[model samples]
Target: MVDFNSTSFHPATFQLTGFPGQEAAHHWISIPFCVVYITAIVGNCTVLCIIWAERRLHQPMYLFLCMLSVNDLGMSLSTLPTVLGIFCFDVTDVAFDACLAQMFFIHSFSFMESGILLAMSFDRFVAICNPLRYAAILTNPRIVRIGLAVVIKSTSMLLPFPFLIKWLPICKGNVLSHPYCLHSDMMRLACADTTVNNIYGLFATLVTYGLDSVFIILSYVKILRTVFNIASYEQRLMALNTCVSHICAVLLFYVPIIAVAVMHRFGKSAPRLVQILLSYACLFVPPVLNPIVYSVKTKEIRKGISRIFSRDFL
Candidate 1:
């Protein structure tokens, strides 16, 4: 272990924040944080295990759900360390390189989640609009390809973001917005020109989430059209119901994200605590709630869960 006092340190450590003015309550608030973190990890892991064990779910939809769970797992694990370090241990100072690594993983997984959502929407599209050809369209190899593409797209685009922010001289003092590193939060601390960073960051967001969101919306619109063309009310309800979990997942991921963005841009005069809380909520809520939504909304997943438990009990 490198002693902080013994040798001259490097990489310019940054202080992570819990709540700006409510530092005293950080530990107390950690109770809920700990609960959410454990629930997200355990819930996503359980979803993954169920999908893996049950061969009946070996379809495009279930495969995409597995990918979503894996991405959620990555997102939870990505930020867990810094959160626990700051809240539980009061270890706030993080080496700059470590911060960048953490940022890369967090943002990369975020982008991956978006990509997976888009892929999931497409899976729903094919299943609903072209049920006969769904298997032909989303073959096992094709799903693997989409998964690889999501990983590649996220990693490649976000890889430069850290290097872009890192070389900049952090003369503004390396304090971050929340208990973790965000590219937007980190860029503000740079003394050097951030025009390139901002441009590229915006570019990445547009290309990734913006484009994905558009396609997702279009896919749903088409699904609705297809569903409505059918005469039977029960059939329409069943068709639309299939999308409920994914829609909830989308909202859970995006709503607070929009709140955080709005707070940062327009709510500058807003309390630092407000912004921090929303940021944390955006990252934490989706992973924790998604597995629950899918497991509850999708009967197959719930049945698998019940069967697993019943077997273990026996």
Candidate 2:
């Protein structure tokens, strides 16, 4: 065993432990992961293309959706290479710099997705709670600004993590918990001081996930109140119906993340495979399911998709 206490210890490469204790089943695992990745890419890309080509989808709601599809695409692509490499090629070694870059992209996109979801919630709130001013409030230029702001905010918040990771002395054998790199997982390998890393990670989590979730809930609360005040029951139902797809999107994105956190905190005795699967669920399920949920629940998107297929057939 290498001396972790050495002052000059720094690993050049990190070995990814993909589904530990399941080496024999890696090939079988790759098949499902491959399918999920492909589906996510195709689904999100289809959503993006339909939104772009359909004139009617130029509205604020769909514009936000276009942002979401883009975020999901980024998230999927960030994890795709290493994940496939581990399961398919049996390549588990990732260069230190490359691992840090992967961690940055994966974490950045995860936070970006939260910001996008928060923005989507705001869009729904305005459209339902204040329909008359929806267009005025969520103007095209303003929407672009919102998109840029979310990207900048999420990216900026995570920008420090890579540098922080580099500052630490990694000496715990450089074995990663998942096929992908994460700030927490990387920090754990540090044989030196990690208090700063720990504190900052918690702070980043709160500012992104915590604040965004609070605002999203607040937006929906106001939305629900506005819907309830509508004189006609049908109108109230219709208004609520508009949020069904977004609500599903939010659940898909947050539930797995929450489960992973809870599992890590409370279920330490949980099987490694189970924890890894939950982590996979956190990263993989949302991208793969978001487009399907939206396509089924949102009429305009469905119509847009149908129109494309119908045109191709004609």
Candidate 3:
């Protein structure tokens, strides 16, 4: 005999909480993020420019690197401006549509970055495992096709997320603890049952990011086995060195993601500041480190970067 419309036990709707009495802490956090954002933009832009300026660097690996740079740029641009606006100008008000748009691009670029990483892994596997067939298998036309597939596939997968959010009957607890509207955090605001959304989100994460990581690990394992079977110690060393940058990049990206997930599950009682800081850390750290890892670890890229700056100065 309970009337659904007459029920008084509605979901608790909390207002958007701004930074609470921590002006100094907020400023400190904002400064470092601004610095990191500048560094990421400059470093990734430099890498992309270097690859574009040098015709010799126009291989499949470099092409994927360029795509990664583009993805990183998109990721940074999607979240940083709003974060800076909030921290610096105290502008925490964001329209629902704008928030959804930011979330869409952030997830889209994240998925695309995962796809590009898988493509890079495939490139390395071919180059090291089957050198003779590398050129034949990863020709210009083939690379173009692969790139298009990456864009199309990532876009299709993430396109559903934002639309689903838009359709949700959100009952006014729109304040996201993190700077951006993350899938899980936004889903928490829905007044309707979110079981389907959670299931789909988990599935998307597993299929795209989780599966990509597994394949990359397998690729490296095979590469390692090949290296061990080779007679020349120098060749093994060289092969191992080639994979160093990729290994570092993967660790940097995934470790933070895992940390965020773990913290969300187990650290629910932790301070809100800790949760927000940790979540934002995961978003920004990988992009900041990616360009540095690639530049330091890849010799040709370093040389290309040098040539780019030298030309600019001339």
Q: What tens digits encode model 2's per-residue C-alpha lDDT throughout 1-314?
A: 43333444668788888887888899999999999999999999999998898887899999999999999999999999999999999999988889999999999999999999999999999999888998899999999999999999999999999999989989778888999999999899888889999899999999999999999999999998888889999998999999999999999989999999999899999987788789889899989999999999988789988988999999
Model 2 worst lDDT window (10 residues)? 1-10
Sort by TM-score, top down from the best = 2, 1, 3
Q: Write the per-residue lDDT of candidate 1 for residues 1-314, one digit (tens) a residue.
A: 22222232223688888877777877887888899999999899999888898898888899999999999989999898999888888888888888899999999999999999999999999999999998899999999999999999999999999889766766666678788988988888777799999899999989998899999999999999999999999999999999999999999987897887788789999976677778888789989999999999999999988998999999
What is the lDDT for 295 in model 2?
A: 93
Kindly list the per-residue Cα lDDT of model 3 for residues 1-314, writing each as its tens digit. Answer: 21112233322232233356675676676787789889989989988988888899998889888988988998999987677876677666666667778878888888888888889889889989998998899999999898899889888888888878766777645566665667777778778888778888898899998999999999988998888999999989998898888788778778878887898789889888777667766778778999999999999998987777798899
Local error of candidate 3 at 192, Å?
1.4
How far is each candidate from the true structure, as Cα RMSD in Å?
2.9, 1.8, 4.4
Candidate 2 Cα deviation (angstroms), residue 206:
0.4
Q: What lDDT does the true structure give each of the candidates? A: 0.88, 0.91, 0.80
Error of 1 at 246 (Å): 0.8
What's model 3's overall lDDT?
0.80
Clashes per model (N, Cα, C within 3 A)? 0, 0, 0
TM-score of each: 0.95, 0.96, 0.90
